[model samples]
Target: MTSVGIDFGTTNSVVAHFAAGSPAVLSSDEPPADWAGLGFDRVLPTVFGRGLDDRPIFGWQAKQRPGSLAAVKRLLRAEERAEVDGIEYSVEEIATLIFGHLKRSGAAQGVGFDQAVVTIPANSRGIARYRTKLAAGMAGVQVQALINEPTAAAMSYSMRSATEETLMVVDWGGGTLDVTILRNVEGVFMEQASKGIQKLGGLDFDSALARLVLDTVSDSDRWTQDERTGFRLDVERAKIQLSELEEVSVPLPGGQYRRITRPMYEQVIQSQVHRVREPIEQCLKDLGGSASDIDALVLVGGTCKTPLIRRFVADAVGLSPAPGIDPMTAVAEGAAVASAILGGDLDDRDFFVSTEHALGTKVLNPNVGLVFSELIPRNHKLPARATETFTPVRDFQDQLQVEVVEGDPEKPLDDDDNVVLKEWTITLPEPRAFGEISIDLTYSYDVDGILHVHGEDSLGNVVLDEAVSYGASVDKRELTRIAQRVSRTLDEDRIAGPPGPSASSLSAADRQLVNDVQAKILPFIDDAEATQLRSAVTRLEGGDASAAAELQAATRQYSYLL
Candidate 1:
């Protein structure tokens, strides 16, 4: 089986693989002509929008579709089920769609991959990580390992860097800011400390620019959804342009423009720049080493390309980031490096992986009467096992149920709707009075970060060990079904070649329809009413006349939110 590495990002996703003893990033050979504005060849945006068939359109095809779900990686942690075309798709299912896209894109380049090493943020909690695993399975691929984003990047750095050095990676990406301190010791990437702000990243910078653009416009609330999308796209493009040039102009809807100089852009985002400095300071503290201890500074993520960010990082870390690293694709490339290690294609040193979350079980507290008992702490090296024995309350316990959770055992999930990561109830073959029996709860966190638990009756010699079933998660049988279904779907895609223009793509006639509908609906609907309008536009692309009906009904529904 060919080994690949997938970097499923918050904004853009990519895949890399080891080919003929060398690692390389993969892109599409010829994207379908119909997917004109979508699928940008090298990077696939983590976006999905409702299509003409009502199934969600993905990748670049979803880009022009108003209300397309972008920044979905960040949103996955907050959501469980999404209403997609009136059919609810679990976050894992949504992620699977993107993964399938990557897999197919790689397949197009003649690589038949059955295994991969996927990377996630270092600070990803249990549920999010679980969903990612399910997603890979859903895409019909076996995940060799789920590595940390920075850790994977460190692997890539180790290959190119000739000397052993204490390195710091400031991963300022679209969804989060992760600061990792590690070392390249004799070709092994050793992690020292990992710290991150999950919610802070390029989106904030875009929002800042968006706010400035909105300020420039009069009666911004009356702007159409297309206008809003146009403005956001322009801001993002100009932000990239400002990196290379001193100034760039953002074209407004009505032939107007918002001129942005690099200095002005820096001024607007200075607060964010200052905010990023916190993690670096904290990373140093965690490492118990000064900035001088960092022999090399490496920048990853597209946001790091900005001059302001580069300058801030230099000042914060007291060293310039080493050149020759391509910030945009380094994480994915590093993932390829890690994938090589797992596939046994390359073995320079042993790679030690760790858990991203703490694993523990809930029980009665001695003082509080009811509390959570932690079995293991976060970042504990994988293939680790923790065993502890506890006594039941009564003479012979008929059965015992223990709620195993991630994070601090003392702390429950912030949301009441969210449940503990794992919970199990083991029944004794014979009814034993509570106090007489001892329950040995053993937790084995495997190399993949999967938690396995077993309860053994010390005297009875009966043990029940099973995989923890979390909410909306599939069992092994269901995983097989999903894998089969995904395999069939991907095979069809491979046979069909590239898809043509989708319902999500906006045509010239569709623009006319949007204009006509917006005029009729805006008087009653004060907001852009993005979803309904986009869906209506999708319907029109599918040859539905009187799309105005969709706009009118949607306008009424959206007006309440205003």
Candidate 2:
């Protein structure tokens, strides 16, 4: 019955629990002796590495180690496994390792680790969120729910404040930058808008500083992998030092030292820092509010420790970050608060989340080919439902293919800015003229941020209705296997030649005969029978003189279905 809050961050992760009526961060039971000295007892570096025996290592022990991966959270959307020293470990596996460690650490603190609420970036896509849940499941920890990082921070912040005020959160972590605007209405926090910039965070700052050091090196390209890693570690240290001191000397791979001034460090990261303004501005615009409307500014993530970042955010919002909210532990603490609320420990507060992207389907337009028909617009509050009516684009089109997509409402269906989440084919009762069959597509988005689609035709016949979280029900590895199986099936088909005669290879008379029978029986036949009939037509068209009898046999068999 002890549910905790876990912030699975990009640069670092933290576990917290609600004990004695307040959220408290948990320190590792077996933490490094100097972890507290380094301000890391409550923070676990999001690093994964391999030990001498090729076993896995995580957290503090894995930092800068051989075959170690830092900022692995950024790669969750791009890849599933990472090859470390000849071993391929899946992203979920790495997350499981991290979660398992956190769970044990909580257990050591006399806290139950069986169920917990986890946090993710506000703009994390469906795949990443799904994988996070999967990882927690693999770790034997049931994820009570997934909360957005900024929303959690707001929750944590709200617990300390008794006044009703609008809050803006700027979360710049190691992987992305998220800006959220929310309001405190009668003690309930409701997110009004959120914006995110991918690949903009603390790690990018490190990379920018590393590039500056590389420019000073004589033969930077020739540095071995080990040298490069060491240099990166040194650069990150120098960057941290530069935040506190006016200047610091970064040790190079060859024992050379490069002095970096805070001014110079800020200049090197100016581009990345400046990009933060866009999300902030957009979030304000999305919520129809400006700097004066925000009563408090909340900052989350270690990256906010940079003085320049703090200054930039303050100047952009015309408000300083609220006092007493620790950037390092706010998210975890907020998650813990969420846990307490869900556990019924707190009865005075609640929160509502908003959708990050527009949800809709693709419709064919005579003028534009295919256009996005938005059902639920972006920034819509969760637990929402929207229905849109569509029809067939072509006469005699017996099946309607509805493609569920999420993205900018203004973007084209095929644009890279939009993603096709799912595709469904609704078999109609019969062929009809263009625009004759009324098909209703309803998209219901639940509070968990999962999407369910309901589709039906004019006759009240249900076509398709299912919960779709980017196919989270199917494991990614299983999806890969299924894809590979399909590919092999296609390859085998190609190698075996046409299952049916190429319409091009058929004589005019044979082509007409095959097409006539196929059109007549395809509507009544099942998929397997339809495929067989097509193959028979192909044989006839392929100049198989013997194929005429086979085609005729299929025609008679299919005729019974009609």
Candidate 3:
């Protein structure tokens, strides 16, 4: 049986299989052409609906229904429950709906696999990843491993190259932007450091452009509710056009309009770009290296296809970006390659997989409410094990709680933030003094990075035994039924489709701002080649303003245009 690799993205998802001789992206029941033009053979919309019959409908079909939620990924971490037509769902339930669709699609393809690997964001913690696995399980797929997105991309790159070199993988996906530095030493690609920002990605750029449009055209008194909504939609379209063309004109109400220039788009999204760069810089600094040290800068993810993103990455890494590879497909392709390797079909000589961080628990003081001992340190190799001892807070205390946490303590709530008291169990023991040690907390991370917490008191008594669970869980069958029913009802109430190209999508004022940006950036785009223009557009449309500013600064190589 072939092992499957799945990239469950926020905006889209794809499944690939390694069979026969090489990896192939699978085709869905949906036509291949219907898939997102950015390239995957099976690009399914990450949207699912609850129909009146309570059966979940997924992909483009689900989106066709009225009020069907398109961006469920945004609600994954939301404390508030998501509801459509009186049916409520948690993130895990939403994931189950999507996974259920994938399962059906795989069955239709007649490819059965026992083990599968799923890709996740670099910054996701053990609990979030575990929840993903659970969701997959509910869909009837057994997850064999959880791989980081950038690592998967690197694996794919290594499969294509024979020479060993250090490379930086900049993955600008729809909902997240991740940067990873890895060294391919003698064919083994080892990650030195990885970092990312949660809020930066393509969607932000769309919103930014929309806001710019609204600001330009609508007056506080004249703007109707419908117009405001329409402008937002138009702004998204304009952003798409700006990615492909030099300038895009959006029509507005009141006989007024605005033209969004490529340069102006870049200015509009400069802050977003800069946000993406901060992590890259931090990764480099952590690795004790500089941009010049990298042999190549690899860009991956749908958002990276934008010209601006490519240019920003190339300029940041001090080298021209690689050609011929589709950034969006790279991660899935790499994941497929890794699946092949794990199945023992591909030569292991080309690449090696190792855990880049250690998993551990901290010993906390009940009385002081402070962490006193460190059990695990970052960057420890995988399949790792570590243990620590803790003393009782009071004399003759009968019970103790073993709190398992993640990440480094020194940084304090950083991107690498640690999860405190994730899982704990009460232990009963004989009376002991405050200074007398009572329990030993041993934290172990399996090959797949799932954390298992084991505790034993001074008497060698096992206290808490279950593996730590993260995130909420829902009844799959019930959720699917509710989603289906809600979806059907929503379709009945639909009078018109989602907001179209109107002043609501982008206002006249926003168009003027885009024009202003064009006046500043058009000369640069005009002088730059097609490749340069594409990179600039990617950076601009990817919606990281800070990254855009960096691209502007780094592209000073074309300073003559300025």
Q: Candidate 1 — number of clashing residue pairs? A: 17
User: Can you give the lDDT of residue 260 in candidate 3?
Assistant: 81
Q: List the residue pairs that clash in candidate 2.
A: 500-538, 501-538, 501-539
- Predict model 1's lDDT versus the native: 0.70
| TM values, all candidates | 0.77, 0.79, 0.75
> Which is the better candidate, 1 or 2, if ranked by TM-score?
2
Give the Cα lDDT of each candidate: 0.70, 0.76, 0.64
Over 4 Å off, model 3 = 29-41, 51-54, 64-66, 73-80, 110-114, 217-234, 250-258, 349-374, 413-418, 421-425, 429-437, 471-562
Position 493, candidate 2: lDDT: 18
| Top-down TM-score ranking | 2, 1, 3
Residue-by-residue lDDT tens digits, candidate 2, 43-152: 88888888887666777677757678878777766575787666786666677667777776776678856678999898876556766775665455667788889999
Off by over 4 Å in 2: 28-38, 395-399, 411-417, 424-439, 457-466, 469-473, 476-562
Residues 1-562 of candidate 3: C-alpha lDDT, one tens digit per residue: 5768888887678888877765667764362232234354467767777666866677766654554566666555333356754577666667755766676677678875534788877766666566677566545455767787888888777767757788888888878888888788775666678777765777888777877766775473576645554555456557766777899887675656898898988888877886777888888988888988888778887778777877877777788876656666677777777777776777663443333333455544576556525565555555678877767777778776655666655644323355553745475655666775577777887655667677787777776554555433233344334334333432321111122122322345434433434443343343433355446445545553433443443332222111
